[model samples]
Target chain A: MAEQDEDSLIGYDPLAWMHRSDFNQDSRKAEVGESEVDSSTELASSTETASNLEIDLDQAPADASEPYASQGERAVLVLEPVLNIQNVSVLHQHLMQMLSNFEAIDIDASGVTMIDTANLQLLLILKQTAIGLQKSISIDFPSDKFIEASELLGIAEMLEVDQAASGFF
Target chain B: MSARIVAVLNQKGGVGKTTTSVNLTHALAKLGKKITVIDFDPQSHLAVSLGSVDPQKSGIDKVLLEGVSLAEQSIPVRKNLNLVVAGPRLQEIEQLTDGGARRGDLLRRALLDGNRDEDFIFIDCPPSSGVLVANALFAADEILVPMTSDYLALQGLSHLVGTIKKFESALKRPYKFSLVMSRYIPTRRISKEVLSVIQKYFPGQILATAIRETALLAECPSFGKTIFEYRPGCRSARDFMALAEDFLQGRMM
Candidate 1:
């Protein structure tokens, strides 16, 4: 039951708040019931964790560590190898912002040298959100470190990574 | 495999909508197919007949309005049969969804949200065109329209058929419909005449076994029981039991 893994998710489940009508069309946003309440609550609980993540992104001065940057219609969310309590906020913001303007989300996991169960859950949630919004997401460039972390948890399939292409050992 | 979701419906009142839902599901359960009956009718007859549920506690409404899980809301009735009672408040939901898709597929999303292990899921819809009926159509893979033997029932029955067709085309998903001729008075010559007309219209769609008008069916619900529990040896019970067999036979057929 990924219940423990679900709890370790450093951010909110965007599905909890985003209703079917919210993504029906950008022009109209209808109030969804449970998804909205649940997502909002999880988002509220992760505020401190998210803020801490924002601070870490500010401290790291790497070109890839810009955390989030635009790529025309598709947005790139640069995740650190060790998401922990540090860079989850950056990922959450990008997920929440998916409904705003982005047609697709490209998760750049090339720098992700380390990841845990909580981080795996975050990736799953992002995939789920993309499906509900009728949007696309491509994690086509995960590093060897990311693949190793995913394999340790036996969730290579859950992340939808093509093993041969993904170098999944 | 998931449960086969079935909605028993008719636009007209007193067409054995609740009667068939209560008795047929119990009969199906008796045959060893896991069953759950959802009383979506605002009248709450299905709940009252099955017994042990608050008339105002619509289990589906809680799933829709209060974020209550479907499994949590169900109350066990007969062996292998669990019941979800309907409240008068359900009518309010129909009024709300008639205008738009703002809260559409509430039932579909809820029923499909988790693992529903029942072999058959029967929903008794309210007697009209509204959100409640729409929800039933959206969620149901099959529809059972229980109509009385008469020419007057033909138009309303046809309208309901058309509604099912429109839903299938619009949703791009197929839904099967079967007719159960209820309240059949065997001695009446008009009964046969109306049935002949129905046969011409529906052909193989009509169930061969008819629910004859009987005091047992009418009296059982008032006592909060179905035909099988009330009088298992009676003709009414046999008719429904045969119908249940018919349903089961259709499965492998």
Candidate 2:
């Protein structure tokens, strides 16, 4: 059964792996206080292995939620992961919690140095949900890399950023 | 002296909004006046054109979105000319207008706090009448509309003028406007007719100087240059310089 699951997830785009590698190199320096794997190599290897497992779609294990994810209604969630982890169940849960409470969500990623395909997909999913429910969701202060990633994906318009109010974050 | 805020706005894209902002700021700077150019457009083309700084690296979006101080993000473009670069993160700032308190005044407060040492501030408004433009109008003392010589340009001028009037009534402040003829071709009869019609409607609000249609203005940005820097003696550059001088001498009135 494990083999069947592994086989099903095998051809996951190799480009994703490349993105993960580039993201790790770019973001590893700022992942402090967010992940136990301090070294860039360790963070990359651990995330790759976790991604290979293709964890179930249900809630992520409590240990996985550690620093990148928080269960708060109005609190600002900071995702400072060093590498790109394929499953962003923790991030999705954070957005769902914000939706349930009808609270404005502000994601502060100023400390983030890199992001992978999983992180990008998580943002898209959150944005889509916010639009569908007509809820006010905002990605507070994203770093340059985060902005570049959004522009690359052609979703820069959806972010709804106001450059003037940036000083308050 | 009270700082003057002028917004270079035209709803229609490619109508010389950015060009006017960049050149006007430079022209004003040449007069020994301290000027700050705010690139309110998320596209960040103004920053690239004047400062040669990448918007992503400058963090102007942070100042607007996270309350980052303008002093921290303001990049010096040239002597007496400073730039507040816009980045992709501005998209988040636009969404803050969910029926909030003083949505239009947020930019006004930011500019007031940021512009301590400046004499004049020029805002390059985006090509839409969204909240960003509203914030700019709330902060500005005067609005300058740059229009090309076309029938569609007249449509844009009417809508923008109406919007400005509405803003003036709501804010209970006098909103002054001047329409500038841009990309004008001398031999075109339609251009002349459009100019006559605008003058009939706006009367004395039209500036005397018209920016002749030229390719130099469009090509300068790709080379990380302004027309003044690329070809100071060229007709386009000289015309813009003259316009800047006329503006300072209060010739627009």
**Candidate chain B TM-scores, in order:** 0.94, 0.94
Where does the lowest 10-residue lDDT sum fall in candidate 1 chain B? B95-104
- For each candidate in turn, the TM-score is 0.58, 0.59
lDDT of 2: 0.64
Which stretches of candidate 1 lie above 4 Å from their native place?
A1-169, B97-99, B251-253
lDDT of every predicted structure (CA atoms): 0.67, 0.64
DockQ of 1: 0.01
* Position A160, candidate 2: lDDT: 46
The candidate that wins on lDDT is: 1
Q: Write the per-residue lDDT of candidate 1 for residues B1-253, one digit (tens) a residue.
A: 7888999988788999999998999999999989988989887888999875566565878887677888988888888999987755776776551323435477887888667789989999988765677778778999998989765676576446545544553454556768888999979866776676567556688887888999888999888888988998899999999899987776211
User: TM-scores for chain A, candidates in order?
Assistant: 0.51, 0.49
Instruction: Give per-residue CA lDDT, model 1, range A13-106, as digits (tens).
Output: 2222122222222111122233432232111123433321221111222454343333224444556546775656565665676435555554
